[model samples]
Target chain A: GAGVSQSPRYKVAKRGQDVALRCDPISGHVSLFWYQQALGQGPEFLTYFQNEAQLDKSGLPSDRFFAERPEGSVSTLKIQRTQQEDSAVYLCASSSHIDSPLHFGNGTRLTVT
Target chain B: SQKIEQNSEALNIQEGKTATLTCNYTNYSPAYLQWYRQDPGRGPVFLLLIRENEKEKRKERLKVTFDTTLKQSLFHITASQPADSATYLCALFKYGGSQGNLIFGKGTKLSVKP
Candidate 1:
């Protein structure tokens, strides 16, 4: 891909509904990251993967938030029992290496009603 | 706990003037800091990065300075243009944390009027 690509650019979910956001990172990107951005706020870290390994999940806010990168090229972030607080932009980023600058996707705007 | 802070207030400047944005951090010493430009409804694009040991860095009209002693960084855009109007963010890698986990400030919005 030319850059990181995310699907379902906008999502509206009801309370208690489950939603999944997908990210297709640049070809051969070695690292992937997920972030959550609230209105008027900077993106906050959610999770990270190096290749197929889930190296970090410490940033996830709660148990309802889950992310996976099975094949290491595409990733998915799933939220279960969504709440109003979950309404925000879900951002996906990828990098060639640990210290490289990240390339970001436009992100999926999730609105939990 | 590590914390990053950017001026919450918006900055307005006339075109052709230099626009400077500040970022400060507390309770952590980052090895590197990065600057990003974000437009409304879009993801942030990487702009620049300065290491703790480097006093300053420049890329065309963009200059970034890092002062580890003061835990501060300044991003300046020389000859600012209205196209530069956007929220500027500062981020750092969390020490002892995930390599890809970056701590970001809320960001400062800069508006350049022609």
Candidate 2:
């Protein structure tokens, strides 16, 4: 794809279940970001990866949230013991560098029942 | 605590009119501010960015003004069309912050009716 791509446009999981969302950034992009967007709210930063290095994960809300980009091309966000509050859209974005405008994926909507 | 705020209410305007949205931040001055447009069920698309030193920036039909003293930014869309309707978000990044530390406002939804 020409732009960032995310998998599993929609997912439903029962409370206490685990879920993993994937993101494929634009090839060669050096910066990738994960964000969570709740209903009627803006996307909140979750974690950021520079190439293969995970430089910042301060935005992750809880210890249950984890993300990784092993090869710097594809990334995954894993949520363990999901709760109803975890239901939201997970957005993935990439940029050529830290300061460049971001290209965003359509996002994956997760619903925890 | 740092906070970013955008108008919680939606704005409705007629086509051919201009629409304005407001974003305000408190406790910290960001090095740069950016505006993005998001349609329903879609991720936000980048629009414009203005640095702290720059007072204003413009594109084809969009203009953004940043006021450091007031800690606010205004986004304007001139000659609005129905196609321009969307939720507009303002994000802030401070210098020396991590690359993905951008903080976003809740966003203001704009509706342009023909």
Candidate 3:
């Protein structure tokens, strides 16, 4: 792929609903990352993966948020029991290697009502 | 704890003028700093990077300066155009093992007027 791609560019979820967002990273990109951006704020780190191995999940705000990049090419972020505070843009990015510049996707804008 | 700050207010500048943006950090000694440009409804694009050892880096109309001693960085756009209107973000990467995660500032919006 030329760039990272995310599915369902916009989503509106009801409170207590579960939502799943998907990301397709560029071909052969070994490093993938997830970030959450609130309105008018910078994107905050959520999780990161090196190939199929998820190296860091410390940035996830709570247990309700989960991300996985199994098989390395595609990734998914699932949120359980969505809350109003979970409304934000979910960003996905991919890099060729560690320390390389990232290529980002348009992101999925999640609105929890 | 570490924190990165960028001027939250929007900056208005005339076309062709050099636009300067600031990024400051505290309790961090990053090995590399990166700048990215983001437009509304689009993801951020990488602009420039400055290493801790390098004081300045330039790519065409973009120049970035990093001062580890001051814990600050400056991004300058030479001969700015309205096309350059976007939000600019500054991020830091740790020296050793933490390579994938990037700590980012809130970013400043630059609006260039013709």
Candidate 4:
């Protein structure tokens, strides 16, 4: 793909249900990041990966949030035991290098009802 | 913890004029500052980036100025068009704590009217 791509543009899961969000970073891009944007707010960083190595997962809200970028290409963010607060737009962005500008996907809108 | 902030209010300007948005931060030194434009219901698109050593950067009609001393960044759009209407976000790449992850501000909405 020309840019970052995310699967399941929209996901509505019942409270307590588990959901998985996928992100496909640009080919050959070495850096990937995941962010969560609540309505009316800017994106908050959740995790970052540099070629399948999770460098930072400190921004993750809780233990229920887990992200993996296995093989350094595709990444998945799994939310276990989802709650109403988990409802937000999940954004994936990638960059060729640490200082390069990021290219973002449209983002997956997750709603936990 | 470091924090980034942008003017929460929306900015309105006439077409062909210029618009300026501000980003402020504290508690951490940033290596670079980035500006992005985000339309409703969409992800942010990169505009311009300025490193701490550089005072300003320009891309066509878009200009950005970074002042590490002031801990602020200004985003300017010259000869603004209606197509330029969007929420403008600012971010910084911090070296410590989280290396590659960016810290973003809330963003300011810009309305360029024709």
**lDDT per residue as tens, model 2, A41-95:** 9998999999999999989999999999998899999999999999999999999
Estimate the lDDT of model 4. 0.91
**TM-score, model 1 to reference:** 0.97
lDDT of 3 by residue, A82-111 (tens): 999999999999999888988999999999
Q: What docking class should model 3 receive?
A: medium
Q: Is candidate 2 or candidate 4 better by lDDT?
A: 2
Clashes counted in candidate 1 amount to 0
Of candidates 2 and 1, the better by lDDT = 2
Winning candidate number (DockQ): 2
Q: State how far residue B84 of model 4 sits from its true place (Å).
A: 0.4
lDDT of 4 by residue, A17-59 (tens): 9999999999999999999998778889999999999998988
| TM-score of every model versus the real structure | 0.97, 0.96, 0.97, 0.96
After superposing candidate 4, which stretches have Cα over 4 Å from the reference?
none
**Lowest-scoring 10 consecutive residues by lDDT in candidate 3 chain A?**
A38-47
- lDDT by residue (tens digit), candidate 4, B92-111: 88666563558888889899
Q: Candidate 2 overall Cα lDDT vs. reference?
A: 0.93
Candidate 3 lDDT for residue B65: 92
| Local error of candidate 1 at residue B86 (angstroms) | 0.4
Off by over 4 Å in 2: none
